[model samples]
Target chain A: MLQTKKWRQYATFYAFVSPWLIIFIFLGLFPLLYGLYLSFTNFTGFNMNQLKFVGFSNYKTVFLDSESMYALGRTLLVTAINVPISLAIGLFLAVLLNLKIKGLSWWRTAFYIPSVVPVVSTVLMWKFIFSGDGLLNTLFDKLQLQPINWLGYEYATTALIVMLLWGAGGSLLINLAGLKGIPADLYEAAEIDGASPVRKFFTVTLPLMTHILFFNLIMGIIGSLQIYIQPILLSGKTLLDSPIKPNYLYLVHAFQQIFAFQRFGYGLALMWVLFIAILLLTVLVFYSSRFWVYYETDQEV
Target chain B: MMVNAGINKPLLRVVVYGLLTVLTIIFVYPLFITMANSLNPLYSLSTLLPTAFEWENYKMAVTTIEFPEYLKNSLIICAISVPLTTLSSALAGFAFARLRAPGKKLLFVIITSTMMLPGIVTQIPTYILFHKMNFIDTFYPWLLWGIGGAPFFIFMYRQFFSTVPKELEEAARIDGCSTFRMYATIFMPLATPATWTTVIMLFQGTWGDFITPFMFLRDEHYPLATALATIGYHLPDNPNVILAQPSSAAAILFMIPTIAAFFFGQRYLVDGIAAGAVKG
Candidate 1:
């Protein structure tokens, strides 16, 4: 009976997780391996019959192709610029909101309203607002200054960043959660030790908030690096017409390659390169975390 | 909730509240203008307020696209997918948190590491896989993804379940409760916050996802995100200028579900939801 019970317990675990296993095996694991396999072959999506193993050539193209290199560099530039600005602004807002203010929830709701609005809808609205006769240019005209091309090639990237930062409430909410997660008793203890507010923040709050900041860093990096849709939407065009060269993000480039140009194998190769790069960077972040990220739990990583 | 413990209280209040109030206006003004424009006729450079409360633009917004069909499809897809994503993720997360199983540690590693994998590496092959299986243009692929257990939501549920005191789990087991019973009866009820968070996330993700529909589904079956795109929502400012009103109006309509989800979910997301889970 005990032996039967052990078998039953094992079966129970499988029973609960069998759905995930079945779906993931066929959909997630198989496709990932298949993509890797395709990356090694000369599969042009429809050339299932005339396939040949052409290893490393596609990967070689990723490094040598000037456009690909530019796209990668631009992605890095975007990640670098957007991540820090977003973190600074988000953390600042979260800090402000963390105080014992009246109607805290109401303020949070009002603040987050813009972010929760549908992106497709909002993108168009922003497009209009940035249009030549739209509000911004109009204000310029009213001030007796020459109207600026807000959506022109020169300013489109800045326009895209503005749109993104406007909706950075997700950052605010997470930081608030992090702030709350810091035990209040820690603050009281610091007060007892005669630490000034500034000193307490630097010593007590900053150390405890590092884990959350680390979470934000990793998420921000991953998110900003893979940003594809914003440029596509903001460029006022379909996937066929690329976002202006300035906003031609790497994923967007890979997308155009696979779908528009039908370089399936090459696209797979490009993606794998990105995958490895992300893996390396993420590992670097994790390694760096040993020095900065603080933790109370001994939970296994 | 206090910060700046040394500052005079009234002075601090005046400054903080004053700054936040100004900041709120700065943030919300653009949206307010857009809302005003949606209800009124064309917004010239100078006009900041609406003279009329005409919802004709909203009427046009619904009529302009395959709104009814697309809305139905979105509703059907989210209604089915959100619960599937939430429940299955919760179950897997609970197992990771509580159960002793073979290769559990390895599975946890797999779960975390897969998150670092760029989504495109899998999308190409998955698209082909779906095409070969003849699941393209159908909701089966979405249903399948939901069953696959979103790795992110699983991590969330795992974190929540892990933080619940071990004594509670032990007490449930001592009462002759099966592990599954402990999950369904004890933990699931206590996990409303995590569940709500996952629900909103899954709903918004599925709602905003145009790529899946754009790539796979025929135009007739396109959802809101895809529909809005092909309907020439792009601004050219002259011939298509009249289209702006309906578009802004549609944006407000489009925002409702996700915003509603946030309002409902935010209550559960309040401070230390799990702190109260452990009973005396």
Candidate 2:
């Protein structure tokens, strides 16, 4: 009787969770493993049945390919620059917003509004901001300064970076939550010990916020590397004038390889390379976190 | 934790307010610019403000972009996907949180690991599979995310459901209720906050997604994001002009729903994300 009851209970459990389990295996796992296999073969567009398995050749081509290498370099450069800039801005805003200022939620809402704005609209706003005759140049004209071409090939990347920083409010919210999580008694104790505001912030605030910062950093790096929409919107093929070349990032390159050139095998191979790199880099970040990431529980023990 | 600002208190307040005001302006300046540019009759940069405000630009944008169709498509996608995703996630979350299941921990770890697999790794095969299944150009690929959405929401729901007191379930069980009955009647109603959080997030995500629709759907089936992006990128026959008024209007129109959603749902949105940060 107990055995029958146990089987019934197990059936109920499976019934509750089966939706996610069944769908994930069929939709997610199947595609991922199939894609991995495709990376090893020359699977051209619309020719799924004729895939010729060429072991290691696709990986070899990806490594030696100049365009692929350049795309990777550009992606890394973006990750390096954008992630730190976003963190600094986010942390700075979080600190200010935590000051118990009046209309705190209103101020936060204003800052965070941009981050949640649809990407299409956000990119459209940036297009005007960086346009030759747009707001920045209008300001330049008012100040009697020469108008610089912000979207020129030389300055396009910088313009894109500035646009990205406008969305740092997302991370600011995370950091602010982290700040709020710190116990009030720590600050009280610090004040009792005669620590200055600056000292209190450095010793108590910064150390406690490291884990949040670490989380944001990992997310930032991962997000920046896969950036597609903004760059594609800015420089992608459209009916309007063409943007100057050399603005294509990794995803765009892979996209063009698959859709534009019908090199499905090469595109999948590029994706695998990106995947392996992300895994390694993520592992490295976790490994390196031992030195800087703080744990209150660890200290207590 | 309070410190005496002394005579400098007012000055410090002024400084704080001044800094925040400036930052707010900086944050929202582009939006003002977009609105201004969209209203300008001549579509000229000669004046920062519109010399003549024109409603014609908005009309032209709507007509040119088939804005109604885009809006309808987006609403349809969000309506179906949100409920399906929330239901699936909530059910699964409840199971993992309360039910006696074998290999539950292992199963959860596997699902969570899916979060790390970048979409690009699966993009090609999924596309081909969908194509083979004749799902391209249909909303099926996106709508099907109801079943196989990202594990982010599932993980979040699990975190949330785990916090609910187990006595509620025990009481429901002692009353001879079925497992589904207890989940639906007792637990789910209590998880209203998590439900709202999941719905809002899923809605926002479905609402904003461009590339998926851009890839899978035809022009007629385009959602708000893809429609707006394409129209903004390719506003016919006006390349050199900085702010093509019609396209700019379209952009503003695209922003309206999302901005409204954020303002109304800010509390839940913030709480949800913060919870994720804490738990993840």
Q: Pick the candidate with the highest lDDT.
A: 2
CAPRI category for model 1: medium
The interface root-mean-square deviation of each model, in the order shown, is 3.2, 2.6
Note the clash tally of each candidate. 0, 0
Tens-digit lDDT string for candidate 2 (B1-280): 5322221478877877898999999898788878888888745663465566788888888886678998999998888788999898888888887777688889898877677677767867888889889999987876677876458777887887787787877888789999889888988887776677778767777898877777788889988887877655343586544336777788888878878877777777777767766656
Model 2 residue A133 lDDT score: 84
**What are the lDDT figures for the candidates, one per model?**
0.78, 0.79
Per-residue accuracy of model 2 over A214-266 as CA lDDT, tens digit each: 98988888889888668767654341223344556787677768877888888
Best by DockQ: 2
* CAPRI tier of model 2: medium
* Candidate 1 segments exceeding 4 Å error: A1-4, A143-145, A188-196, A298-301, B6-8, B42-52, B166-175, B234-242, B271-280
Give the range of the ten consecutive residues with the poorest summed lDDT in model 1 chain B.
B271-280
Native contact fraction, candidates in order: 0.55, 0.59
TM-score of chain A of each: 0.93, 0.93
